[model samples]
Target: MILCCGEALIDMIPAPVQTGGTGYVPHSGGAVFNTAVALGRLDVPTGFLTGLSKDLFGEQLRETLGNSRVDTRFCILSDRPTTLAFVRLTDGHATYTFYDENTAGRSLFPDQLPDLPDEIGALYFGGISLISEPCADFYAALAMRDADERLIVMDPNIRAGFIRDEDRYRARLDAMIRRTGILKVSDEDLEWILPGPGPLDEKAGAIAARGPKIVIVTRGREGAFASFSDGTMVTAPARRVEVVDTVGAGDTFNAGVLAALASDGLLTRAGLEEIDGPRMKSALEHGARVAAVTVSRAGANPPWSHELSGPDPD
Candidate 1:
């Protein structure tokens, strides 16, 4: 099973109330949470590892997970307040304003972490968990500790707005990248991490040099590209769809890729290292398929396994 490690929070999404004015509505989401939900919905044997609260929103997040069939045995429960993200969408894009101080997901300590079960063949980490304080340090340490024992996948999912210390965050990110086996990235995320003066491949190469056997760079509607440590590369075109809002496109895409990898027996470190162009292409297709379903709807809701066989958006 793939264990997703990161934050869990409630997203206050904008909606049109009866007054014909905009108001906020709560939804269960967080980068890692979104991916875990997507994985479960796709019928992947997935579990979540994170700090969750006992608050109403937290309970709601928990219920969402349970409903989606995600294993929650690894969660560290607390009475701490749940993190809240107020998301604003312009056209079909999403931006956010977060109120995350001292929340359950952000205040995690290393001791709170449960010993990972051996059944977890791969671990996925990303989002604010890599930049948020005490928890960030704890997560980095956990990923580093298990780097050699299992497959490690990371999607920096960098949100420049949330980073508190540039140098320190960069150091933590670089360290995690070194330990990552499959580093899935968006073109935008790449610019944020490896800023300026070169092409996308060169930037990905720098990270690949640090360790990751395969670097997957996604370009929204254009498609995605994968760079291997062996110096080979491949690309996949994104599926066309009517985007309602891009709330959890990247996270669902991560789930799709993992699901595809798991189905192809390439969910392990050795399989990733030996991944070929066609296999990478097929995985990217899965990611695009899931993502297409996500943005075609409202909020961060991804497709159910059976939903994929339904009607087309366009």
Candidate 2:
């Protein structure tokens, strides 16, 4: 099972109401939450590890997990309020304004972390949860601690506005990247991580040199580029789709790559270290296909197993 560790919250998105005014509608979302649900919907054995509130929004998030077939036994429940991110869209792109002070998912302490069982072969981490305090440290520590035993996959999904301390966050990310087997980042994320004067692939390569066996740099509509630690590079083109909104596109893309790797039995620690160009390219293509379906719809809703063409990755 792949255990996704990070924030899970409600997204209050804008909608057109009858009076020609914008109305906010609540949707269950968060980067890690989206990936976990996407994995579950794709029929991968998945589990979620995060702090959840007893609030109504938390209940909605939990129900979404259950419906997607994700295991929630690892969730830490509390009376703290749930985090809410209000989203704005412009021509299919998305922006978020978050209200996340002392929320359940942001307040997780290291002591509250659950010990994982043998079934969890991989651990995925990312999003604003990595920017929040107490919980960010908690997750960073968890990822480093479990690195030796399981495959560690991370997509920082960096949101610059949420980071309070640039130095501290960069340090934390550097440490995590050293232990990460697969590292996925956006073009903007790559630029921020290694700012100034370098080609995208070179910058990605620099990151790969730090530690990750595989470094995937997603280029929005252009698609994704990957660099393996063993000197192999591959690229996958984005699928052409009439995008409705890009809410969960990257999150679902991460799930698709993982699912494809899992299907090819390359999700294991050793398998990742020995990954070649073709296999990695195949995984990226699969991710593009999955993400295409996500962008073609509304919200963070990823396609169900039956929705994709060909044999199920599960």
Candidate 3:
């Protein structure tokens, strides 16, 4: 099982009303949550670990996860309210105003973390969960705890605006990256992490030096690029599809990559270290294909195994 650790929240997206003005609609989202759901839909044995509220929005999130077949037994339930992010989409791009203070996901502590079962072969960490306080530290601790055993994957999905303290967030991220076996970042995320005038690979290499064995950078329509610790590099072009909204595209892409890795029996730490050019390229293509289906639809809705072409990941 690939156990994803992070936030599960409600995205209040703008919807058109018959009365002329726009109204927001609740959508089950959050980067880590989206990826977990996508993986489950792709027929991967997936589990999600996060702090969940008993609120109505939390119920929606739980239902969504259940429908997608993502195990939620590891979730820590609380009476705290669910975090809400009001989204504004400009030409299919999304920006968020998060109401996250004191929310269930943000209030999680290190002590609340559960012992993992041997079935969990991989552990994924990221999203706004890495930006907040005590919970952020808790996730960082979890990653470090299992760093030597399970395959650790992370996609910082950096949301700079959500970061209250840059210094602390950077330190936490740096520590997590050092333990991350596979690290996926967007073009914007790469820039923010390094922030300089240089070639993409050069910046990605700097990040690779920190510890991640494999580094993947997703460039929206241009596709994705990956560099391995052994100096092997591969690229995949984005799949063409009519635009809906970019929300959850990157998250779904991460799911595809993980699913492909698992399908090829490369999801283990040793397998990732031994992965080659052809296999790496195949994974990238698979990721792009899966993400295409997501962007072609609205919200963070991902395609089921039957909805995608070729064989299922299982």
Candidate 4:
């Protein structure tokens, strides 16, 4: 089982206008939330750990998770309002403007964390959850204190505007990276975390030296690259598709990778490192293909297992 820990909130996306304009449409989203839902849709045994409000929006969010078959027994319900993010689409990409200060999700406490289940093979985390206060401390502690038996995957979905304190954000990110076993980040994320001149290979190598056994750097439509501790590196180009929106593509790609690993019994660190070149290539290709399906849709909708298993693009 793979457990995803982070914020689950409502995203107010722009509605397509038939009269040559744009309007807002609310959808359930949050980086980890999207990943968890995608994993659940793929028939992966997945759980989500986070705080939710008892408000109407929260109810809708919970219903969405349930529809996706994500286990939400660990979710905490609060009287506080649910977090909301306004999403704007431009050039096939979505930009989020969040409203999470003092919200229920950001108020998560360490004591609220559910016990790490023995069945859990991996723990996945990232996004604004690492930028908040008590919750940030809570997740950081989980990353540090958890035994190495379980694989810890982290994706630092960088949003510079949401991070008020640059120094604190960098420190927390570095700490999280050190604890992560499989670190998946985008090229934009690397630039935000480590801003400097030079090749990204050097940047990725520098990050790898900090600890993670594997690092994947996604380069949008150009494709993605992965570097392993064994000094093996591989790249997979993005699949061509008529992108409707790139909102949750990366998050769904993460789901695809985790789902593939879980299905193949590769959720453990040993299992991960044992993956051969062909298997690794397959995993990367599968991730890119899954992401392409997501990009071709609207909002955070990812492909189902049957959809992903269909024929590849010719």
**Residue lDDT tens for model 2, 186-241:** 99999999999989999999999999989999998899989987777999999988
Q: For residues 13-53, could you state the per-residue lDDT of candidate 4 as single tens digits?
A: 87778898787777999999999999999999999988889
lDDT of candidate 3 at residue 173, scale 0 to 100 = 96
Better of 1 and 2 by TM-score: 2
Rank candidates, lDDT, best first: 2, 3, 1, 4
RMSD in angstroms between candidate 1 and the native structure over all alpha carbons: 1.6
TM-score for each model = 0.97, 0.97, 0.97, 0.95
Residue 231, candidate 1: Cα error in Å is 1.1
**Candidate 3, which ten residues in sequence have the lowest lDDT sum?**
305-314
Total clashes in model 1, counting residue pairs 3 or more apart in sequence or in different chains: 0
Clash pairs, model 4 backbone: 15-23
What is the C-alpha lDDT profile of model 3 across 1-314, one tens digit per residue? 89999999999999999999999999999999999999999999999999999999999999999999999999999999999999999999989999999999999888777899998989999999999988998899899899898999999999998888999999999999999999999989999999979988888888888999889999888889998877779999999889899899999999999998999777777777767878888889989988988998898999898888666443
Q: 294, model 2: CA deviation in Å?
A: 0.5
**lDDT leader:** 2
**Could you give candidate 1's per-residue lDDT for residues 89-189 as a string of tens digits?**
99989998989899899888877667887878899999988889999988998888888888999998999988879999999998899899999888989
**Deviation of model 4 at 98, angstroms:** 1.1
